[model samples]
Target: TYITFPIYSGITFNNISSYVGIQAGIAASGKRDNTITTSINGIASSENQLGNLSILLPDFGIRAGLILKLSNKLNLHAKYYQGLINIFDKETSLSDFTWRTQQFTVGIRFSIRNTNDCGTCPAWRT
Candidate 1:
């Protein structure tokens, strides 16, 4: 599991808006399941165990997305996140490759606010 903090800047034109952001994340807890399979003659067996996978504590990433304003209080959105850090522990593993993360999301957003809300409006609008 990871806890992430994202900071974004956005622009809106008509009913569409787009944003780009950077994120700082940390893994609170992690584990991996390792499966081993063996075959002897015509017989096969498998075993599974929860292994301790060492994850680098801190992570960084970039994100970009688009939001379509369906109304003042509703929107549709999609985003992509690319991990910039290799979370795998290179010191513990013999693999020569590094691991990163890529995530894609699509969702709807709902809000409870009036069109004339002062605190939530942009400075230019107020």
Candidate 2:
């Protein structure tokens, strides 16, 4: 689950806009049990009953996206998110873990009543 709050947006073209935002969310993973075996300093060792080898939950991230207006009331969007904090628990020897996500969306938006006429096509503002 996640929630996004758009901080800023601007028109890049006649019907296209770019936006930056902050997102807060939680990530959950199921549980599993396994065993791992390795040799340290030429000594063989084996560990059994290993579990909970997933990233930590309740994470936060930043999001950025582009919005392309398909029609007066409809738009298409592409977004990307990257987690700020490492969600990896200290269950393994490996480090450097983070969450990354991408999204494509189609939605509707309503504009206020105005009489200003900008007679331009979709790519004109560029």
The candidate scoring highest on TM-score is: 1
Give a tens-digit lDDT track for model 2, residues 1-126.
Answer: 344443545457787888777766664554567777899899988787746656666566677778887666556777776667666664563666554444455555544422133445443345
Task: For each candidate, give its TM-score against the true structure.
Answer: 0.78, 0.49
- For candidate 2, what is the TM-score? 0.49
Tell me the alpha-carbon RMSD of every candidate: 4.6, 9.9
lDDT of each: 0.86, 0.62
lDDT of 1 at 113: 70
Predicted model with the maximum lDDT: 1
Q: Write the per-residue lDDT of candidate 1 for residues 1-126, one digit (tens) a residue.
A: 888899999999999999999988988788899999999997999999998876777889999999998887889999999999998888888666688878899999888675546576676364
**Regions more than 4 Å wrong, model 2:** 1-13, 28-53, 92-126
RMSD of 2: 9.9
Report the CA-based lDDT of candidate 2 relative to the real structure.
0.62
